[model samples]
Target: MRQNTTPRGLVQAALAMTLVGTLTAVSAAIARYPVYGGQAVRYAVAAVILLAVARFGDRSRASRPRPRLTVREWSLVAALAATGLAGFNVCVVEGTRYTTPAMIGTVVGAVPVLLAVVAPLMERRRPAPRLVVAAMIVTLGATAANGLGGGSLQGLLLALGALAGEMAFSLLAVPLLPKLGPMRVSAYSAAAATPMLLVVGLLVDGTAVVRIPTAGEAAGFAYLVIVVTVGAFLLWYDALGRIGADRAGLFAGLIPVSAVATTMVLGLGRPSAAELVGALLVGCGVAAGLGRRVRRPAPVIAVTPGRESVRVAEASRP
Candidate 1:
């Protein structure tokens, strides 16, 4: 109502998760592709697209000077690329060998709680109790949505690594976002991640790395490059800067819900009652975490001619 960016931030966060969640299924299209090699391509393509859009397409942004990165900031971007981008894509793909996707998703679902706890601590403040509790609720909702599927010990570890990457994706960017902004951060991180992923692809696939993709794999990579990499990164990082990591983190719960919804849309399966309840809980948790408040008019005091105060029935809204 007052030019508040929080609502916009919330919407962006939701949209980002939607892209990520819906694309979760689409990723299987490229399952046969070399994992590291495919991701390297995706990141490289996305970085170019982002850089072009950020630098050339936005004329309004031309006047604003871009910030140069300090050494520490460069280090952070490197770590973010390595762990959050390269490591996450590799482990998440590899993890499926040891367990069900639901189990891995269930473990990775803890990102909300992780961000809610760690983000505030990074700022030298105690975590907000309400936000923390809401994060827990969202985590529970995600777990329910994922059906609490079972996994092997190694799968559990891999899922934990994915969780760390997801957490780092936001927390590390918290420092960089204010300086570089979302577009630059997205652009730079994607560029940085390409080399790392390509190296891994080379090591893993040897001379066979970076083969020509099939039609379906090409389509899948296009979707990832345009939506999940370019669009989701900008949306999430911008939201994180606006509403902060704690609040934005709650939207991570939507990943599983959106995945379920996508399955339904694709006629793959119907959602169970637990998933319905989980979606409801996710909505409730996000609403509560955002501090949705209602206001009422307070009783007012009136001054009579004698300057004495008299009780009045109503007052304007505060």
Candidate 2:
């Protein structure tokens, strides 16, 4: 079934994700300074910011004006938050330890592809052939950009897992949109995931959390909280709500392209001609695939608050 699609909202969401990816890559570079895990540091910081927002952003909603969730709904939301938000963050950070930032970014870029596959599976449908092709091209480009020569097996593995984490997040989050609005969904997810992450961070990093970070690390942590965590989540869920999860995911492929470019611009490293070509091809391929949006019928559930979920639209899938 097709849905009432919103082009402008989708574009804005894509732009937000792209910005998050770029900023995340740069922050990773900055995190390299303190010998603490950039991924862990950024996430821990992000959790704090998210909690603050969740607490203070909407005091009216704080008491939960909506009806209380059934036990099942709470469990589902917790699982979704744990795997999608929490799991993705942890894996990406841990993956960076074993992989190059470029490699991590590239693999992370493939999240759209993963979402394409996973979304269809969740909906009990088959994905389009063009999406499959786009995903493959993006994968090949990611492999090339990550210096896929020899002796990089560990990085490759970690990168792949990171991609999986991202896809898992996207797939799990889609169904939750209609149940919990984007703000509450994200806030609750982040808040729920915070405790577990804190425990993990304490166990893994030890006293590092209390230790003062260098100027650069502090800046990186702040950027991650402001940009990647807060900005990215808002845009991501907003996109999911506007378009179906599948189309929204298509734009995710731009992440690695942005990350690699950002890295090169910062003089950390330059992509070889081959890598550059790969990045562009991946970016273009994903965009081209997404550009083929066919108007479809609206979902059975109302995504917007106080509005009916179903809408009159065409009869093709994304």
Candidate 3:
């Protein structure tokens, strides 16, 4: 595990929150357009942008031989594309059709809890007590923050589907990190998922797949493509490399808070007192869960050419 805190890691966390924040705003566009078609367009745009960057943006990367994935790695990448990109978008878009974005956001806040449970099982170890407690606290806070809002049974079930997709996507990607690095993993996953989404969109949305989006819808779709899909995924994977998935997952607790703030900004409504209280609990729980006591490094002894060895203290963890 990475022992030191990093500015990049913090930025990744912020980007993750930003990604979630975009979901509510993007829901407006999804509502305006066909769900599968909108998603297909967004992913296709993002895939093209990412692939272009990967292939020709930097001279050194362009010159290096492209990284080849083993059959197993390729299989994992396919799974990541399916569950994380295509499946997640489809589920979220469909779920939002029957439920409010706030409710969906609240449901997604369970991701950290799912990760806390699954990460230990994947590693063949018992779950940490503190992590378990933190997960529970986060869940409670998320539920309260959303006021336990009611939605249709189908909507709730679909929201759960999205949750499952998200959990699977995250867990599956962890094992592939060493082979493909974050950007390649994200770029390839997006590219792989684009064709799948296009096929699905054609089948489900019919000729609506070819419809052009309005100015507002286009703006929302662009944000979803550039900021949420590409930028957020890259930042998330990068942070996962630095902090390990378990700790990085806990940052998901911020999603509901961001969603609520986004809602208010859109003039939806102010947060209720309970929601404010819940947001505070979420903040505290996330801090407690992620907090670690850094171990001091052993002092190093330097050997000078003609002098006695000198002891020097190493830099502390940030």
Give the top-scoring candidate (lDDT).
Answer: 1
TM-score for each predicted model, relative to the true structure: 0.87, 0.75, 0.84
Candidate 1 lDDT: 0.87
TM-score of candidate 3 to 2 decimals: 0.84
Best by TM-score: 1
* Steric clash pairs (candidate 3): none
Q: For each candidate, what is the lDDT?
A: 0.87, 0.66, 0.76
Candidate closer to the true structure by TM-score (higher is better), 1 or 2: 1
Worst 10 residues of 3 by lDDT: 1-10
lDDT of 3 by residue, 119-173 (tens): 8788788877777788778777877776656679888987888888788767888
Q: What lDDT score is found at residue 134 in candidate 1? A: 94
In order of listing, the candidates' clash counts read: 0, 7, 0
lDDT of 1 by residue, 1-318 (tens): 111335788899999998899886797789899888888899999999988887774576777776788999999999999888988877887788898888988889899888888898998989988889999999999989988777799988888888888888888888888788899899999999999988988888987778899999999899999999999999999898888888889999999999999889988889999999999988888888888645668887776887666758787675
lDDT of 2 by residue, 1-318 (tens): 233356766676678767865874566646444332454445556656665665675574666655457788788778876777667666766766676666676657666667667787777989877776776676666656554432267777866777776776666667667766565666667667766666666777676634566787687777776787777887778777777666677666666566678887888787688778767776776676666555567544335668766654444344
Sort order, TM-score high to low: 1, 3, 2
Q: Please rank every candidate by lDDT, starting with the best.
A: 1, 3, 2
